[model samples]
Target: MIDSSAFQGKKAIYYTLGCKLNFSETSTFGKMLADMGVVTAEKGERADICLINTCSVTEVADHKCRQAIHKMAREHPGAFIIVTGCYAQLETEKVSKIAGVDLVLGSNEKADLIQYLNDAFIHRAEGTTLHAFHAVKTKDIKRFQPSCSKGNRTRYFLKVQDGCNYFCTYCTIPYARGLSRSPSIASLVAQAEEAAAEGGKEIVLTGVNIGDFGTTTHERFIDLVKALDGVEGIKRFRISSLEPDLIDDELIEYCAGSRAFMPHFHIPLQSGSDMVLKLMHRRYDSALFARKIALIKRLMPDAFIGVDVMVGSRGERPEFFEACYRFLDGLPVTQLHVFPYSERPGTSALTIPYVVDEKEKKLRSKRLLAMSEEKTHAFYEQYIGTERPVLFEKAHRGKAMHGFTDNYIRVELPPSLARDAYDNEIMSIRLGGFNHDGTALKAELT
Candidate 1:
């Protein structure tokens, strides 16, 4: 319901923070504005409006949200700034206090942004008044429904689920995101098919917790993948991040055989010590997590496995940290995402004893990062001289094209294979060697 007459040809810039869910929502918002005859512009360019989709996962994220607002305001003083997402939902007062933010919308009120902007513009034209929608309770607002697949990407992130149910002592996601919810299987398949037809080679299923997908009728995650595997045109499918407990043998078996599914898994293991996991309120222990990895290896030995680890957390001493290092070193994971603990307000972890010192935290982080590099190199070395299917995306930085193998290995193509046809096209690439960062593989067309 944007006022087309007041700003018929105005341009808008969108900045998204946090996960793939935020990106998907921002894209939807962009499309909605486009339908209202508003043009889209890249960030830092002159635009009439600036929209920020924010995150509140860590204190650093909060700082980034403020920095983005200040930076954008400095660049374009006349533009109207609108803020939405988890940060706005939980910290509305803090966000509203920022210098150039004109309107602050909660997570649930995001769908009404277009209408709100129209009203604001109409009032401004009449010189009547100015208003702001801040501190709107998320529970009172209706859900902003997701749209169909109208936009396209070479690798599309289809958000089939939202929110979380687990109340981890060290997390605030449950409060910010609410309970778990998922789209229907019929709707998901329709979206996937549209993305496939739109030249999307891979569809990455993303959510707060994708493993907890179906809540409607107890439908399993594998059931959803089975439906997506039948969709035509999409040559590959991947999952974002899943909980260790949710990954069962059945899901592993399905991905092992499915031609469309990619051989990759990213599971978060916040702490490798069972005692520390208990304090963090994680459901599964390290033993169970290791078993899950073993099962995956048994099915697909060459699978690209990624694990998340917290470098420093409550109740983690030197001995506990050693246990974590030993556990991960023995695993066949391709890489590790190491996060140093950053305390958030209202989380039980903030009150725990034996909090790691900043110096020690950095040391632990560096150690784990070195382990990640070694593990990644070893994994890539195993794939030397192997030929895998690579979907080359647009060429960038002077005739170099980049793509990925089915197992999520980053493949770079030489100038010979990097023709214009490589854009949004899938081709076979030979895994010739590894770059300095073993996560990336130097490839030639096979």
Candidate 2:
């Protein structure tokens, strides 16, 4: 329980990194602060507290977490700094040693922030002390932490599931997030209704592995989707990301004809080579991944598909790299999220042979990024001279406004449309020629 008067006039600012789940969790903390009468700090305003939600999936992400902590501390010298999320969960002692972090919470303890902060404030007023570090074992992160983003009304990331069961060799997510688990379907629906009430137009279902839903209960991911599609007020629900093996024809067919589900999918295909898949301990092979995309395209040709790829992991010789390149060259994917592999401490991938050098990793990353741009351009070219519903997210960004269609194409509107009336509102836009820089599609009001 919160005494609203405690925070009646204070302000808190938040900085988030990593996945949709992290953003959703941060929003939950923000909502708790709001209930306690703490408002989010306005632009260029000072805040009493600064919260940083972090990620440690890759070496780059870990570096970013550390940088953000130090940056926030330096920028707001007097603010009470709190750091939580994957990096904090994995490197609790390291984060606690950072110069201005007052408190560090593990993944499991993040949801208990309201209680922890309340105690800290009480001790502060009474001239007592509070612990700076509060972290539990990863195994204790068993329960689901329900979170929904309220900062953005166009699309609220609704975390229905948490943790991961598959401990892939090159991955630290399982160690950082704990085991796979989910809340009941009924519970998710209640949360979705609340988000809709908060002016959320779309709900992006996010998790460590959303397709692995219902492991605790008897329900399935399909069951959850069917229920959410029928919810009133929400314009659509988007599957943030999912595994290839978990996506079946049944789920694809349901989404194809659903009234609320969008036509977009982001499946991680780390390496196209089957040998690399085995080395990484991935569940499905390249053939199954291609088949899944084919099925989705057959059902909905206009569907946008994004794939995650790791450019340079262990056990990738020249031939294996060629196999991966060939596989991706043949696929009909719309976009690629290219990542260069970096070994994590205590992961099985460190023992794998043929470690790729950083130089080669950069080269491979550049190649894949070029491929991605070409694929994205081709995907957008098809929609030229077509009209689609564009949900304008930011109506004022320098000189132009930006929005996205149902299939996830970035549409840029002229300065004339840069009005508060179009912000967070869905409207029909006509796709015109490709921009001068070939970055985004030029769109006009239809």
Please list the residue runs of candidate 1 whose C-alpha ends up more than 4 Å from where it truly belongs after superposition: 42-44, 128-131, 134-144, 147-153, 216-218, 397-399, 415-417, 436-439
Q: Which candidate is the best by lDDT?
A: 2
Best candidate (score: TM-score): 2
RMSD (Å) per prediction: 2.1, 1.5
Please list all clashing residue pairs in model 1, or write none if there are none: none
Cand. 1 Cα-lDDT: 0.82
Which whole-number lDDT from 0 to 100 does residue 242 have in model 2?
91
Candidate 2 lowest-lDDT run of ten: 390-399
Q: Write model 1 residue lDDT over 163-281, tens digit each, in one string.
A: 78888887777667666778788888998888877667778888888899886447878899999999998888889899998998888999999979888999999888888898898
lDDT string for model 2 (1-446, tens) is 75556667888999999988888888888988888888888878888889999999888899999899888888787777889999999999889899888889987888888777777777777987565887778777776788877564467888988889999999989878889999999999998999888777888999999999998877899999999998898997899999999999999999999998999999999999999999999999999999999999999899999999998899987788889998998999999999999889989999997888999999999988999999999999999999999888765455788778999999888786677778778888899978778877998776
Off by over 4 Å in 2: 1-3, 129-131
Each candidate's lDDT (Cα)?
0.82, 0.88
Which pairs, if any, clash in model 2?
Answer: none
